[model samples]
Target: MTAPLARDTARERSRRRAARRNLRSALLFLSPWIIGFSVFTAWPLLYSAYLSLTDYDVIRDPRFVGLDNYAQLAQDPKVLQSLGNTAFYTLVQIPLYIVVTLALALLLNRAGQRAGLFRTLFFLPKMTPPVAVGILFLLLFNGQNGLVNGALRTVGITGPSWTTDPAWIKPGLILMSLWTVGSSVLILLAALQNVPTELYESARLDGAGFWRQSWSVTLPLISPALFFIVVVNTIAGLQTFDEAYTAFFGAGNTTYSNDAALFYVIYLFQQAFEFLHMGYASAMAWVLFALILVVTGIQLLVSRRLVYYEGGQR
Candidate 1:
């Protein structure tokens, strides 16, 4: 009994030593991430939350106002307008982006030997910087001499002023947003390639036509990619800033920055930096964060019903 007890104790010590070594290695490897999160991410988030409850400007110390900023948000017309703009952008852009990307992916998937070249060509647009895209879009959508209007003139069609016209500003932004659909197309293309050939064969054998097979088999198989694109693009649409700002709110162009292009993030930026309303901006940021959380949660809930994972239970 004593001999067996000694052997078990030795084994236990060896296991404990191995666990300690593993833990030390893990901590060593994770130290950079831990430090980065604490310094940059976690600290900023906590500080912002605290700031949201105070009256803070860059030059002065924060004074506790205890939700005054949030209360004021209810009556702010700009806030409401910005939220509506963002919501409209999110609702319109996400579905259009998904549809366009999916269609491009389907086309590429059917391109046979030319698929790789087509994919590379399609993906090139995503590599273009957002600022550059915004500038390009501004030039393209210029009311008088822009390429879009120029083409319309050639066809004897009068194009609306896309940038200056309130009715067309959001539509112009949506059109600009479509330029970055390459990433979604690539994701869906990858998902499409992974879809089993056997499934397509089975689908065909059942007398299912191309559209019917695509509706049932292709869509279900690629639903995960679709869900990912929808969630990411919706969040991006809600936080739109760079494009609109670059196009309409450039330095010394305050007069051109109309209410129609006032996205939530752009408004928050104007509050924080331009107007020196740090606390109010912080509150707006938190509100935006909450909105994103709620939207993502709803999407997750809906996805459980809609998205499919092959060979796995729903």
Candidate 2:
């Protein structure tokens, strides 16, 4: 009995030793991610917050300017236009995206066709690099010999110079934006398919029609996902740079002519990199962060009236 007890104690000690070794190994394995996060994400975020409060160009020491940058943003006409442009873009894009995405999701959810082929076809636009797509769209909407104009000519109507004309540039870019709406459709389609079939079946027993079942059953179930897509796409639209900048060619004194195609970020980039105003750009980034937070909070608050959760009390 004594010998057996001694052996068991020895085994327990060995297990403890092995556990400590495994923990050490695990920590070693996780160190890379820990280091990367600290270096790339945490450090830069903290530094940027600090930079926002100072007026430091890259070549000089930063001077603490307090709220001067924020004050400037408030009074700047270009900033106001950019803000308005972004707001308009967000307002137009979010709903259009939601409608188009939901329509596609519903259509494809029951499409019964080979979903893989159709899904690939729709998602191809999303896969295209934004820069490439923007460049292609630039030509497609051109007034002369552009595909859109050619099509319009065929119909005995004229198309305006899309990129060159201020009146049509934003609209042309907005149309370009539609090409990537496919990604949202795919997201909504997933949400639609995730909805319980039993709910629709039960609703049918109550003499509900297709639209009725969808209104009460489908929409509610998918509301959570739709809500997420709305917020994300709104943020994306607010950060509209790649398409607008790539499609735009500031041929004259227009930094963001034709109604300020330079959305906040694009304008910020021009100020920071083009004009070498790092401190000001940093301030813009902070403002953008605040704006996004406020907008997102508003959405979440407003969503309470619209978004319905399953199996949980609101």
Candidate 3:
């Protein structure tokens, strides 16, 4: 009995030692990512939280100010205006973006052997830098001698001043958003191809026509990809800054309607860099983060019903 007990204890000790060795090996492999995340992502996140509670400019140490910045945010008219503009952009752009991308993906999917070439051609626009796109937009929509107006003139219709008119600015931006529909198109196209041909055959056997088959089979199978595109586009639309800033605020131009183009991120940039309101900007950043979190949460809840997963778990 004593001999058997001693052997059991020895085996347990060996297992414990092996487990410790495995843990150390895992830690050694994970060290680079852990260290990088701590320095770059975690530290910035924590420091921003602290900065949001204090007044900090680059020149001086952060002065503790509690909730004063958040209080000011509520009363700031520009904050309200920017939020409204961002909300409008998200609402209008997302549906149009999803429809256009889906339609293009369907068209490309039918191209068979020629699909690759068409995909490359469509994706070329997305490779252009945002600043260059903004400049291109300004040139194309210049109202007087622009290519768009030139074409409109031949058609006996006058194109509105897209850059200068507040009424046309958001619509122009929405149109510009379509220029990068290639990414979503590719995603949907992949999803469309992944859908089993058996499902379509079954639909055809049931006497379903083209529209009926698409509505019943194609949409349900590709619903997950569509949901993904919607959420991503919504987030991007809300954070719209680069193109609007380059077009309207860059090079000290004062002709365009800033109110129409003043997206939430652009205002946040102005507060942080242009005005040196670090604390206020930090607060704005946190508020935007919270808003995005809530919106994403709501989307997740909604997607439980809308998004289809083949494995049966939402």
TM-scores, all candidates, are: 0.97, 0.87, 0.95
Candidate 2: pairs in clash: none
Ranking by TM-score: 1, 3, 2
CA error at residue 232 for candidate 3, angstroms: 1.2
Flag regions of model 3 displaced more than 4 Å.
312-314
Q: Estimate, for each residue in 1-314, the C-alpha lDDT of model 3 and write its tens digit.
A: 99999999999999999999999999999999999999999998898899999998878999999999999999999999999989988999999999899999999989877899889988999999999988988888888898888999999999998888898888888888798999889999999999999989999999999999999999989999999999898888879998999999888879877789999999999999988988889999999999999999999999998778998666
Better of 1 and 2 by TM-score: 1
Q: For each candidate in the order shown, give its overall lDDT on alpha carbons.
A: 0.91, 0.83, 0.91
Q: Per-residue lDDT tens digits of candidate 1, residues 1-314?
A: 99999999999999999999999999999999999999999999999999999999989999999989999999999999999999988898888888899999999888867888888888898899878887887899989898999999999999988988898999998988888888889899999999999988998999999999999999999999999988888888889998888888866466453688999999999999999999999999999999999999999999998999877655
RMSD per prediction, one decimal? Answer: 1.2, 3.5, 1.5
Q: How does residue 200 of candidate 2 score in lDDT? A: 86
- Looking at candidate 2, what is the lDDT of residue 107? 84
Cα deviation of 82, candidate 1, in Å: 0.3
Query: What TM-score does model 1 achieve against the real structure?
Result: 0.97
